[model samples]
Target: MKKVINKPEQVVEEMLQGVVAAHPQYVKRIEGFNVLVRANGPTAKVALVSGGGSGHEPSHGGFVGRGMLDGAVAGAVFTSPTPDQVYEAVKAVDGDKGVLLIIKNYTGDVMNFEMAAEMAEADGIKVDKVVINDDVAVENSTWTTGRRGIAGTVLLHKIAGAKAETGADLTEVKRIAEKVIANVRSMGMALSPCIVPAAGKPSFTLAEDEMEIGMGIHGEPGTHRENIRSADEIASHLLEKIFADMPLQQGDEVAVLVNGLGATPLMELYVVNRKVAAVLNAKGIKTAKTFVGNYMTSLEMAGFSITLLKLDAELKALLLAPADTPAFVQF
Candidate 1:
């Protein structure tokens, strides 16, 4: 229950204020909603909007900038944003070129974002949506009907945003996003659970020497829990599962993302990445690019996830494109 805040109920609001205050040049709040839109945007090109619960920072919100999301609607911690909030975000970011919504494959997220899309269509806004389900974990989890979307969503954002920035139409942008979704795979393990402020207790329990493989971001049940193992062993387990599902062949080029689940240190993430790269090399899967850090997180949870995107020329180019945002920037 140790959290820094005036009140549990006000965390989202205060956090939004802080985010807007810190990044005024990049984003602004929607006044009465928990939506954050790129400041002075809705450019002539297609606009991108995405969102979910608030705990995973630098995600749907921090990405609202030049080459990423145009708007983000944040819900309460681990809760889905209302359709009204998402609808407002669509309205704010929709240009004549149309808008795209990048949604994770959570049930609530899909339902809410779809409702918002329908509402926006009623208002004459051309909206298209893509649901990310890149996790190679179990098919159904506590909050989702299919495989949950994990860190791979960030890659989707970058690639899709880059396409949109090129003035691609909504259909084209969505097609690119779908390609990323189809080729990417991810798996995660958790060492510790996180405490939701309002709940005032850890979402789940784990022993000092235990970890759960394929754990969902919201502390949903994983494939199984067992005694913690060495970094190399953990990475092999995760990556092997991903490989079995996606089947990387000899000389296949891929991008790597070793994402922290909030509390894990960069040192540990790099350790995992080392093993990941070694595994890929031994399999003759050439690593095209490597990213290792805390990209997507489950508020204060201790763990990491690895995502591999099997790349083609188009995806590689879009991934390497320039982007300027609060959480991600590349020249």
Candidate 2:
């Protein structure tokens, strides 16, 4: 366990403090709680909150800003935040309008966020939620009940947050989020596993020349493993599976996200995106917008995921809306 840290138990707290120190203009820490809220929060609109384990950097936390999340609760590494912590986030961000919890499709995340929503409702805070299940990896994984939410959740955060920022009510926000979830699909492949500081070991193991297809973010075992191949071949395999599942056709415009799973370099990501774009172009799917970066990650795991969102006019506009977050900025 060669990690630079004071103590494993205090890693999340210290890391968040460092994030606040690094980006004070964008984020602030809630006093005495493992919650990070936008510096200018309680924005008098429908507040958006989402979170999970601490390892997925720039996710629930880096997203707390003007056009994305209002608050994000952090748990221990690769562990869900407690219900009470989530309840605090809801209370801290709720205003005259309401709050919307953007929960991913994981068992622990769903359960804890749901419990917090119930607690918030008890206090007369109008709350709605959208569970993102965009990963088309597998039906039943050990980590989640249904399909796991992966990089596609970033698009959900963007589109839904844009709607909420426009003063959409809880019902409308939830509707828009569901619409995004319905149209988006994602698939990921892992080149290497990540080592959780607390665990002091890699989550999983892979051979030097092997890759895990359809892997989840938590380093869960993927559907299968195979000898590593060229970037083009991997992109083709991923797109084939995603397109087969979603069935996009000619002349359909879509937003594409080629996300690095923490450790993959930008150069490699661009190479992968080249192949993804070629495949989509050949299939007549017009690439309306493309984002290639580490929007969502699994610690320092070496891998990437591709997300495709079939876009309508409404989705296009919302997706293009201005967003000012730590990791993503669109204007």
Q: Model 1: per-residue lDDT, tens digit, 177-204?
A: 9999999999999999999888989978
User: Ten-residue segment with the worst summed lDDT in candidate 2?
Assistant: 137-146
The local distance difference test score of model 1 is: 0.92
Clashing pairs in 1: none
| Candidate 2 colliding pairs, count | 0
> Alpha-carbon error at 304 in model 1, in Å?
0.4
lDDT of each: 0.92, 0.91
Misplaced by over 4 Å in model 1 are 140-144
| Weakest 10 consecutive residues of candidate 1 by summed lDDT | 137-146
